[model samples]
Structure formats: C-alpha cells, structure tokens
Target: MGSANVASTLVYMAERCTSMRYLKLIHAHAYRTCLHQHTVVLGKLFRFVAVSPFGDLSYAHNMFDQMPHPSTFFYNILIRAHSHSTTPSFSTLFFNRMRQNGVAPDEFSFTFLLKSRSFTTPFVYDTHGAVFKFGFSRHLHVQNTLIHLYAVGGVTLSAGRVFEDALKVGLDVDVVSWSGLLVAHVRAGELDVARKIFDEMPLRDVVSWTTMLSGYSQAKRPREALALFQEMRFAGVWPDEVTVLSVITACAELGDGEMGRMVHRFVDENGFGWMVALCNALIDMYGKCGCLEEAWCVFHRMKRKSLITWNAMMMVCANHGNADDAFRLFEWMIDSRVVPDGVTVLALLVAYAHKGLIDEGIRLFESMQRDYGVEPRIEHYGAVVDMLGRSGRLQEAHDLLTSMPIPSNDVIWGALLGACRIYGDVDMGEKVIKKLLELKPNEGGYYILLRDIYVAAGRTVEANEMRQAMLASGARKTPGYSWVEA
Candidate 1:
C-alpha cells in the first residue's frame, strides 16, 4: 500500500474500530511510524479511535483539549464516538461542551446524539429540537434513524410519520426501512399490520421475509409465519439459517409432531440437517411436540453435538418429567467433553428439586461454578431457590439470596416471597415483598404476595391493605397456575 493509503487507514481505524486492543496496537505502530505527526493526520486518527476498545471520555476530552480550535469535523467524530461509547453522562457532557466550543454541529453529529438518547422516549424528543436546530430532520439517514428509534420505543404512529416523510422526499427507501416498520407493527401485536407490510413489499429479500416470520412467531401467529415460509419457498427465495430456525420454532409452538415430522422431511430434503442450529431446533420441536424418539433421532444423527444440543435434550427430558433420563443425559453430556451452560445445570437442578432430593439439587447447583466454571444466571438461582422454597427450607432460600453476588430481580424475589407465604414466614415474606414493591413498583405479583403473606400471618388488616393497594394501582395478579397434562 502507498504511504497515503496507510495514513488514511490509520485515521479510519482510529475513528471506527470498536475493539480497543486492535486500536491500541495500531496507535502504537503508527506512533512509531510517525504517521501521527501531521495535525490533520492525527486529528483523523483520534476521531476513528474515539470509540475503540481503549477509548474513554478522558481520551476524547484529551484530544479536544490539545487541539487549539476543534472544528465541527473534530466534534462530529467525538460526538459520533460518544454515541457508541459506554457512558451516557459523557455524551451529555460533550453535548454541553459542543455549544461552549463554538463548533457548528453537523447532521452526522446530531444523528449519533439523538441515537444515544433513544432509550428514553421523553429524552428522544429533546434531541428532536436539536436535530431541527441543526436542520437535519429532512436528511434521509437522519429521518430513517428516527423512524427506527420510534419503532423500537413502541410508538408506531411516530414511526409512520418518519416513513411518510422518507416517501415524500423520494429518498429511495430500502428493505431496512420496511423491516424496521414491520418490527414496530409486530411489537404492537398487530399481525394484520405485519401481514399488510409483508404483502406490500414491492421487493422482499431474506430480511424482509425473516422479519415477517419473526413477527408472526412473536405475536403467536405461527400459522402465518408458516404460510409466509411456504410462499417464500414457492417464490424461490433461498431460506437462510434464520428462516429454518423460525419455521422450526413455529412448528414447536404448534406442537403437532406429524406436522413437525413434515418439517423434518423438508429440512432433510433441503440438505440443512447438518446445521447445528437447525438440528437443535428440530430436537426441541419434536421433543416438545411429544415426538421424543424423533428428537433423539435428530440429535444422534448430527455429525457433531453442540453444548446447546445437550442442553436442549436435557430440557426436553426435564419438561417431560423424565428426571432420571435428564440426569443420565447430563452425565453423558459431561463425559462427551461439552462445557455445560447455565441452562444445563439449572435443568438438572430443577429435576432433582422436583424429586425432593434437596441434597442432589444442592450438589449440582454448587457444582455449576466449581466443576463447570459456568457462572449461574438468575435461572439457575431460581431453580435452587424454588427447590429450597418448596422443601420448606425458607431460611436457606433466603440465605441463598443473601449470598448471591448480585441483587435479586423480580423473579427471584417473587419466588422467595411465594416461599414465605407457603411456609407462613410472614416477617421474611414482608421483607421480600417490600423489596419487590420498591424495585418493580408495578409488578402485580408483589401485591398478591403481600396479601398472601398477611393472610398466612393471620393479619387480616394488613391483608386488606394489600388488597386495597392492588385495587388502587389496578395491578392484576398473574395466574399462579401451571398445567401438567391433567
């Protein structure tokens, strides 16, 4: 490569490479090569590296501090990097600094700023005035980004306004624009809207079909995703890995083995049987749909088994109430040199917990980190906690919560709160209940737990208070029922 190209790439990597280590190596090498001596060269270099792995707010501030008069070009790069950076306060800091620096903000600069604030709906509106201040509301990429922000934030109407504007500008709307809108439609649970978008696609690519399929799956419209799949097949759109995954998951949800078997045939005929994910999904589909034999067949037929494959089988066994088979499968999985994930241990512990073998459950739960080196997620914790709760070791369950490295979330707290009511430990139950109410104020289960705890403690007045709170907040308790093929 020429010296000019090398210098340019050095600038680009500094500005764009997300990995910190790679950026540092490049930075070190360029420093040695004197590629960073030129002010223009170093300025571009710092901008590209702004969001790289080693980049922090200090690095950006240092760059700006050293420059005599940082232009919009410099601030734009800094602002853009801040968008991808980990700190929100830093973005706010830089936005405040932008006005003080007397640097004129550009479209790219504002777009990233708006994107950084996209998580909060009200904060996003604040960025809108700034976008208009920079006069970039009409830019196609800027508008499209806003549409996506709106769609993700669950405001389909606001999303539509952006899409309509994109059309008015005759700004060649691509599949991404359509896909984003479809996702928003899907999130709204408007399957008809998703279907309309699917039909209106003048051109449907893999993502276009995949989006509709996923939308159908999410909204519990598996049949529609399946129909779209059939249409995709007829239209000769080559199904990628995602298409097969959606179809398999849809078949699983349908719980029709005969239908699942047909999908199996289609998958095999398409020569996708060798794909690990497809195999995993097929096993899951057949297992859940009561075709355990087919699931085992698909699992064994795979040339290689992934950790997910083993974990999926374990889950299937546990779900079918075949705890013995589940444990045996876990043993085989361990012998086969696969490092188990949190799912595997949790499934095994749950099986043991169900059988009331508290010792076995405890052993496996402890072994998760000790033997497998896999850190337990809340699912793993929940299984063990529920085990202890059901077995009437309420204090032990509470102790587990105390011992956890992280604070309990709603599900964990809810389980313990449920345990308190079960064992009639009103005081501890109230403690869990208070935490739940404080953390997840809107969770209906907290009120239900509060009432149940009061009732268990024979405090009728407190129970009435909880009921009144539930009514006042309009928090409906989720059904605490489960079906076991009864």
Candidate 2:
C-alpha cells in the first residue's frame, strides 16, 4: 500500500478497535508492517487508547514513548486526554516534556495545561507567565482559559485584569471571557457584580446565562435565579440541560410546586426527559415542594436511575415523614442492585428519626459503614443525635455528640439544645448552650433558645440574664421570613 493508503487503513482500524485486545492486535499488525514508525499511524493508535472507554492511558504512554520523535500535535493529544483524567497533573508533566523535546507549545497546549491544574495550584501562575513568554497571551482561546483559571481560583482581580487586557488589546472578548469573569465574582460571593457583568455582555450564550443562573441558585437566591431564567427565555437564549437543571434547583429551593411543574413540563417538551440528572433534579424539586406524589412520579418514570436518583427519592420520603415508604425504597433499591451510599443511609436515619424510632436509627447509624461500606459522616451523626434528642435520651445524645469522631457543628448542638428546652433539662441546656456559644457566639437564636429553656423551667432570673448577655454581645435575632411562588 502507498504510505497514505497505509495510514488511512491504520486509522480506519484504530477507529474500529473496540477492546484493548483488539487494539493490541492492530498495534502488532502495524509493527509487523513497519508502519508503526509513522506518526500518523501512531497518533491514531494513541488517540484510540487515550480516549476510548476501554482505552488505557498506560498503553497510550507506552506508545508515545516508543515514538522516535513525537510532535507537538502528539503531545497535545496526550495533554488534552490527561486534562480530563483523574491525574490532571500528568497533563502539565507532558507539557514540560514537550518543551524538553524542543516541540514549541501552542495555544492548545496552554489551554489543556490550564485545564489540568484546577487553578488551586500555584502551577497556574507559572502557566500564566508562560502564556506571556510564548507570546500566546493575545490568543483568544488561551486568554479565555487563563480567565477561567483565575476566575475559578477566586482571584477576581487577576481574572478581571486578564479580561480587560484582552479587551484593551482589541481581542474579541467572547462570552467565555465574560462568563469566566462573572464566575470569578460569583465564587467570591459577589453576585451583584456577576449580574452586572452578565448584563454587560454584548452577546449572551447558553453558558453565560447558565453560569449567572447557577450563581444565584448556589448563593441561595432562588428568586433571582428563576427571574433570570425568565429573562434568558425572553432573550431567546435556549437553555441546555445544565440551564434547566439550575432552574429546577431554584424551584426546589423556593419550594414552588407550580414553578417546578412548569420547568418539568419544559424538560419534557424539550426532550430533556432522558437526562438522569434532570429527572433527579425534578424529583428533588417535587419533593421539596411538598408534592410527594409528583416526586414519586418523576422517580418512577425515570428509565435510568443513578444512585443520586434513589437517594433523592429516599430523602423525599424521609423529609415528608414517610418512614415506611423510605424503608421500602431502601429494600427496593437493594433488590435492584443499587448499593446504598452515605446519603441513602442518612435518608433512612432521617426517616427513623422522624418516626421516633431511636433504637432503629442508632442501629442503622452503627451498621452503615460495616453493612453498606458507607462511612458515617457528620450528617449521620446529626441525624442520630436528633433522633436520640427527640426521644428525651439526653445523656445518650450528649455522649454521642462528644464521642463523634468529627467535631459537632452548631446545627447538631442546636438540635440537642432544642431537646433540652422540651425536657426542661436546665443542666443539659446549659452544657449545650456553652457548646453552641463556642460555635456561634453571635447567633442570637441559640441565646433565645437558652432563655426560653430558663423561662420554661421557671428560672426567670437566669432567663433575664441571658437576654442581657445577648444584648451586651450585640447579637440581634434574625428576623424570620417566608417564601411563596408569587
């Protein structure tokens, strides 16, 4: 065969290669043909092994090593592949090796390298400097990546500088640049700044809208998120799965069954019903909205269920006090070969807690790691503590709290304090109050709870003392608020 034909044939075989065994056979044939020396042939083989589901990075690395002289293209393929892998650091290693091999790195090299570091590492700063040294600072793709890297690291100042530098140089700053800056501000907890950037973008893409929408959702400003979704729709920007997922989450947070159903209908109409994540989000939205039947409907209709899907449904049952149903779902989940995770066990514990089945809840908590290989997290500890506290097992609850491998948080301490208020255990209340104050000294609610415990116990002088202490500490009770769809 001509060299071109030989390369073409090998590329075809590489594309058709399904398993490692088949890939190895093809490699052996290429070696026998002496065509393996060709970079084109090796490139195809490396890509197949690097990217295919059954692909092995080790095998690809071996193929790369055997290359007499790998080109920048080959190094980039390796770098890009590793950028998405568990060891993203390998991408940087490959880039360094590329430099050592005297292969000049291109914009793509910097893009992939930036992706690998997760921006948490100081390595990102070195890569940023390299972009300037290599004179790719003006490269749009590379600049976008630098913007993203800085933004994701919560370095809003650096991200903004990169963004403005691009604009200053008359580089066409695209939505990616705008979104990256927006994300930087969002990560820094500056939603208003992110919104201003979002509004200032000359062109808005799905990603730009979704990033802003998600910022609102994550910041616990669901009303703004939903309102932004409406604006996205009016602006004729179609939402992708991620955008809809954010909308569903916002609806869940608002506990707006009506809005959730509207989003669900949109998901169905847009053919996004096939997404397992969307289904999971819908189930969660329905559950939070107090629409148990609707939540179950979404769960039951899902043709493919992830562990999260089952966990969401189980939590729905737990949240709504459906202990029997939660347990039944656990059995069904196990029967279907879906192993329970920490969240699953937490849901069951929550269900047991709601039903006042303290013993059962404790038993499940104890056996979670041994039986399901799901180690108990602080959440499990909190659920069990709440369970025991609800049953007036104050001493046991206190013992569990102190014995917890992880430090108890304010929420767990608050749960125990509430129980103290219920049972009029002034002594226990004092102990819990001490711990709560250590955790959240400025939280007036805990002070109020302790005062209420004193009042209930007819210790008016102590109650008055707590009020005075609260005032002295300049801790104001947070005003309560409620939310409705309207």
Candidate 3:
C-alpha cells in the first residue's frame, strides 16, 4: 500500500475499532507499513486510546512511551484522560514529565490539570500562577475550571472571588461559570446566595438546574428540591441520569412513593434502567418510600450489582423488619463470593436487632472482626447495646458497655438509660442520670426520661424534683414534628 493509502486505512480502522485487540492488529499493520512513525496517525491512535470509553489508559501510556517523538497534543490527551481516570494524580505526574522533556503545556493541559481531584492546595495555587505566567489566565475555559476546582475542594470563597472578578471585568461568562458559582455557594451551605445566583443566571443548562436541585437536597430542603425538579421538567430541559437520581432522592426524602414511581417510570422510558447508579438510586428511593417489595424486585432484576447494591437491599430489609430475609440475602451474598464490608456487617447487626435476636446479634458482633475482618466501630457497639437493652437484658447490656474497648459515648449511654426507663430500674436509672448529667448536663432527653421513670414508679415527689431540675438546667425540650404529603 502507498503511504497515503496506509495512513488512511489506519485512520479508518481506528475510528471503527471497538476492541483493544482490533486496535492492536491495526497498530501491527501500521508498523509493518512503516506508518507508525507518522505523528498524525500516532496521535489518532493515542487519542482513541486515551479518550475513548473502550480504551485502556495504561495501554495508551505504553504506546505514548514507545513513540520516538511525542507531540504536545498527545501529551495533553494523556493528561486529560488521567485527570478523569481513577488515579487523577497521574495527570500532574505526566505534566511534570512533559515539563522536564521541554514540552510546553497548552491551555488544554492546564485546564485538565485544574479539574484533577488529586490536586493539592499548594499545587492548585502554583497552577494558578502558571496560568497567569503563561497568559492563559484570561482564557475563559481555564478560569471556569479554576472555579470548579475551588468549589469542589470546598474553597467557595476563592471560587466566588474568581467568578466575581471575571464578571466585574465583563469577561465572557457562560452557563458553566454561573453554575460553578452557584455550586460553590451550595457547597459552602450558602443556599440563599446560591438561589439568588441561580435566579440571576441569564441562561441555565441542565447542570445549572441540577446543581440547584442537589443544593436543595443537601440543605435538607427536599420539598424545595422536588419543586425545582418539577420546574426543570416544565422548562423542557431533559433530565440526565444525575438529574433523575436527584429527583428520586427528593422523592425518597419526601416518602412520596407516587412521585418515586413516576421517576422510576421516567428512568425506564429514558433507557437509564441499565445505568447502575440510577438503578441504585431507584432501589434507595423505593426503600426509603416504604416500598421494600419494589426495591427487592429492582435488586433481583439488576444484571450487574456492586457491593453497594447488597448493602442497600439488606438495609432496607432490616429497616422494614425483614430480618430473616436480610440474613438470607447476606448468606447468598457471601455464597456469590461478594466480600462483605463494614456496611454489610452493620446492616446484618441492625437486622438482628430489629428481630430482637439478642444472642444472634451478639454472636455476629463478635464474629465480624474474626470472620469478615471488619472491626467493630462505636456505631456497632451502640447497635449491640441497643439490641440487648431492647431485649430487656439490662445487666448484660450494662456489663457489655462497661467492658467495651472504646470509651462509651452519649449515644451508648443514652441507649442504656432508655432501657432503664423501659425496665423501670430506678436504681440503675438514677445512676445513669448522674453520669448522663455529668457528660451532657444540657441535654433535655435524659432529664425527660428520668422524670418519666420517676412518674412510672409512683414517685411523684421525685418526679416533681426531676421536673424542677430540668427547669433549672436551662435545657428546653425541642419540639418534634412530622411531615406528610397531602
């Protein structure tokens, strides 16, 4: 084949190549045809391997290394790929090597580096300096990336300053810029500021809308999030997987199964049923909405499942009092060679507790470290204590608490105190009140529980004294409220 024919053929093959094996075959053909030395052809192959979803980054790096003369374009592609890959720090590593090799970074190189999750604070500042020194600081894309980076790192102030400066100077601001600022405010927990920015935006993309929705969700304003999701749909903006997931979460928080089912239908109609993240969100939505049967159906139908899948399903079962089912699913998970993490162990313990299986819960708590290699944390200890206390084994629970390897926190102590009230052990209840008062004198819960215990035991005078103590302690009972969708 002529050189032109060979290069054209390689390009055509690279475009259509889906498998690495096919790409390798084409590379061998290029090598035999003496076209492997061509930078354009090599760049295409490198781009395909670096950016394509089917591409392997390690293979791309190996091929890049084999090139006798790597171009700046090839270096940027590799850096960009690494920035988004699992090991984002490799982007900086490659950039440093590029600098050592005297390959000056283009605007794209710095832009990708700025988006890296692994960039340290000092490194970000240094890159900021480099952007100015290289005269790319004025580049709109680079500035937007800097805003995003700062926002993601929880440095909202710096991001806001950058965005404000850009707008003050009348720099060409786009949806991304506005969205970044909005997200930065959301990350900083400045919800009102974020909403103002959202309202002021000249144009809002799906990302902009989604950011506001997520901000509302994060702020625990599920009602507002759902309202925003409806507004987004009414605006005719197509919801992506992320937007759909956020909406489902809002429905979960609202415990609105009707809304959740609507989102589920939308997901299925939009062909996101195969997206694992979205499916997982569906499972969570159903579970949170008190639809355990629907959640299990989704779980069983999932062709590909992650560890999170098992944990979520198990938790839902445990929460709904399906302890035997949760344990059976856990056994099946172990049989399938899916290694259980701490979440899985915790869920099973919760299941045991829900069923009031004190002995089984204790055995599992003790065996977690030995069998699953998952060490018990304070939360696990609390669960075991709560379980034993709920089972009316007050002394055993107290003994376990006293013998705990870790110091007991207010949660564990409260668990025991709660049991003291349930079992009406005035002696133990009074002792618990003394310790609880010393630990947290300001808490109204311990005082209220003690007062209830005294009243239940027919000690009206002591109950009156406890009530007076509560009043003098300056601790007021916080009002409790519940929500239901009309």
Write the number of the candidate with greater lDDT, choosing between 2 and 3: 2
Which runs in model 2 stand beyond 4 Å of their true positions?
1-34, 50-55, 480-486
Q: What is the C-alpha RMSD of each candidate to the true structure, in Å?
A: 8.9, 3.9, 4.3
The TM-score that candidate 2 achieves is 0.89
Enumerate residue pairs that collide in model 2.
none
Judge candidate 3 against the unseen true structure and give its global Cα lDDT, from 0 to 1: 0.85
Q: Each model's TM-score?
A: 0.63, 0.89, 0.86
Candidate 3, superposed: residue stretches over 4 Å from native = 14-36, 48-71, 85-87, 93-103, 121-123, 331-337, 460-473, 480-486
Which candidate, 1 or 3, would have the higher TM-score against the true structure?
Answer: 3
1-486: candidate 1 lDDT, tens digit per residue? 777887877776666666657666776767777675556577755755575555555766765786677777777777677677666545556776877877677777767777777643365677766776777877877877777777777678878877887898677887778877876777777778877987897888897788788878766777877888889889999888788788888988888677678778878898888899989999899888988888888888989999999989888888787899888998898788787888888788878876778988888788778888888887888888899998889889888987898767888878888878878888888778777887788777677666766766789898888778877987666687221112
Best candidate (score: TM-score): 2
Candidate 2 residue-wise lDDT, 308-426, digit = tens: 99999999999999999999999999999998889999999989988888898888889888999988888888888888988999999999999988777999999999899899999
Q: What does candidate 3 score on TM?
A: 0.86
Where model 1 places Cα greater than 4 Å from the true spot, the runs are 1-40, 51-61, 120-123, 168-172, 256-280, 297-310, 332-346, 349-486
Provide the global lDDT of candidate 1 against the true structure: 0.78
